[model samples]
Target: MTAPEDHDYDVIISGASVAGSAAAIMLARRGARVALLERRSDPAAHKVLCTHYLQPCSYPVLDELGLVPALEKAGAVRNEARWYTRWGWIEPKAAPSGPELPYAYNIRRSTLDPMIRSHASGTPGVDLLAGHAVTGVIREAGRTVGVHATGPDGPTELRARLVVGADGKDSPVARFAGIPAKSHENERFSYFAHFRNLPLRDGITHSWFLEPDVAYAMPNDDGVTVVAVIPDKKRLPAFREDLEGAYLDFVRALPDGPAIDAAERITKITGTVNYPLHSRRAGAPGVALIGDAALTSDPLWGVGVGWALQSAQWLAEAVAPALTGRGDVDRALTAYARRHRRGLAGHQHLAADYAKARPFNPFERLMFSAAARDAGMARHMHLFASRIIGPLRFLNPVALARASAVNLRHRGGPSPAPVHLPHPTP
Candidate 1:
């Protein structure tokens, strides 16, 4: 079960960003030699078009890497989200899990990515190969043995016991491995910008579930606030006609939204026309795909950063013992894939369904309406949205019954219709 002694490394991870760097650091800590490859030559380069939200689920992984302190020092903000629904604001006064507040970390990826990649580079047993792009895989005897990459030194082939694809959505490694993704089209587009001196409360992120449309204001490092609008595709024409004007009007129309009119806009409005949800098999042969390479779901839930970090932790823990010659490496990778699916499948299913820009169904209406009136229901919802608990737990029979009872008590009067902002004629 030992790894090939002739191999250059036990694990070669492509795309040294959130997932790749975390995987390299965790594997190296377990005494495995790792090659962390990144295509970008600049060490400070980071992803700009990102929500920059990390759910509480990823905190344990960050703590293990000893990066939490560094992140906090670099101005990461801890924020609990408040959701605005037709019924009212569903705000949980306390976290159901404990006395601690339910909060996630928000830090711009421009600061987060390079910081973690730097950690990987400094770790022992990890060769941080910047400017190395994995162009293809090395297949031998129907198993992936390594990768063919282009670097500053020119085209090179590095053999490894296992290859990991941690690249983002359009993963070249997955494509090279012939692992096709099942994509789901999203019916919404997004526009956001960073602002300064916005009079928003610290430690609280605000979100509005405007039925088919969604919006949020997230406060992050150094007084920078991210104000975003994710509207259904029907509004696309208007956005295309007057991008900034439409964007600003959407934010201003949010019920009790941020005072963006007075806040200084610090950056140009960034927009995403289409971000399709994709899911692929976690691995094939000796190659494993982590992060977005494995699955890309709706960003409306802000699950990207957390899932990336969490998947890396899972992969390292599952494959480390095998890389050290304790068991079959392929079997270990399979176990990692199974664990990943079991942990995230429900969340992904719900997220993808919502990404279709459909109206809130009966169950969602029941839950959201009940959560607005009942503290217990609100706390349960907070736990689910924070990604601290999975869907099964969140939708348990007991919770459903409770929500039903909460709604029945309010049946004396007709329910108020959801408020919708009037869209400007294109």
Candidate 2:
């Protein structure tokens, strides 16, 4: 599986996490040489601050990797989320497994990251370098050609037809390639802790959009519930004053006493003031960026994990022919860059707007209120919330008309009667 004694590798990926591992695994399986780099030598370490809820959009990719059964056996749930909107809880029925999407996964990064990396390491033609930290991208005539990295053995240079930046937001590869990442001023901060023995609501994750504050309870594998609270910057003082007390009160004050009230937190309450929100252009002459290196939006929605896997899938599909020596590398890189924008630009614009911490606008009020009254309305709204569709599609003219009709029907009733949502359609 060596690179024909010409190039040191077909691709040298600069992170061994989700995006990097995914790219390496797929590229190597396609018979291209790959060097997967990770800063940490230990495979079992986990990212403590993530919500760790994988969207159903990524189910097919996990299935392709043959990790679906393993993930389920290891306690990954078939994830479906509930939105506590201003009107009421907009809960869609769980997505049924079919020929396309299998199911979503809810598992800790400690369990999931290592599992993916292990699969990448075992795939033939992949050189999994666990402790390699990429120092800079090697450029040849204004094109990225390799990487200069510091590993356990001091320093090494890995040459490749393409170098990929799968590193997180502050990606050195993107930096070295001079890809300017545009970001916004974040007006909110988030804090979270893991609690065991918390009762899940129908085994689905719940997100409460409480004005300027957002809170979520995501049930993960091994009976652990991750409770996260994101509040406006205005409330940082209270949390800074009493981290644990403020966090506990926030979760307990939800309309009903959620499971966190009875359950005990097993991990320390962790938080961050500067949760980054941004995007880079996604490619250079001989390089491409995947995952957070390319774009990371509002964590309040928790699409990062799914998008990470998806960007890798897109990169592999766009560049597979080039990696196998059948097409132009620059052309493949351009295809990936174009695909990145096509798939994510509109979505990122909406996320950047919401990250401003503004309360519900008129459109949200219309959608949320109408969604609770009609079974069909909630289903489409759920698709948008689940990242299955974009905002524009969800709030199209046709949908707005339906929302108006639902409101008219509600108005016809006498003084706020209990309007039940119709039995959910199959």
* Residue 263, model 1: Cα distance from true site in angstroms: 0.8
Q: What are the per-residue Cα lDDT tens digits for candidate 1 across 263-353?
A: 9999999979999999988967889999999999888888899999999999999999989864688898899999999988889988889
- Candidate 2 lDDT over 1-426, as tens digits, reads 224356798899999988899989888888789999998899885566677988877877888788998898999877777777556677665345523322487889989998999999999999999889999888878888899999999999889888999999888899988999999867779998998888876877888887777888888899888889888887787778888878777777775436676787898999898786889988889889999999988888888888889899999988888789656888988989999898888889888888888887778778887887787787777677667777789889999999989878888554432222121112
Give every collision pair in model 2.
Answer: none
The lDDT values for all models are: 0.90, 0.82
TM per model? Answer: 0.97, 0.93
Most accurate candidate by lDDT: 1
Task: Name the lDDT of candidate 1.
Answer: 0.90
State the TM-score for model 2.
0.93
RMSD of 2: 5.7
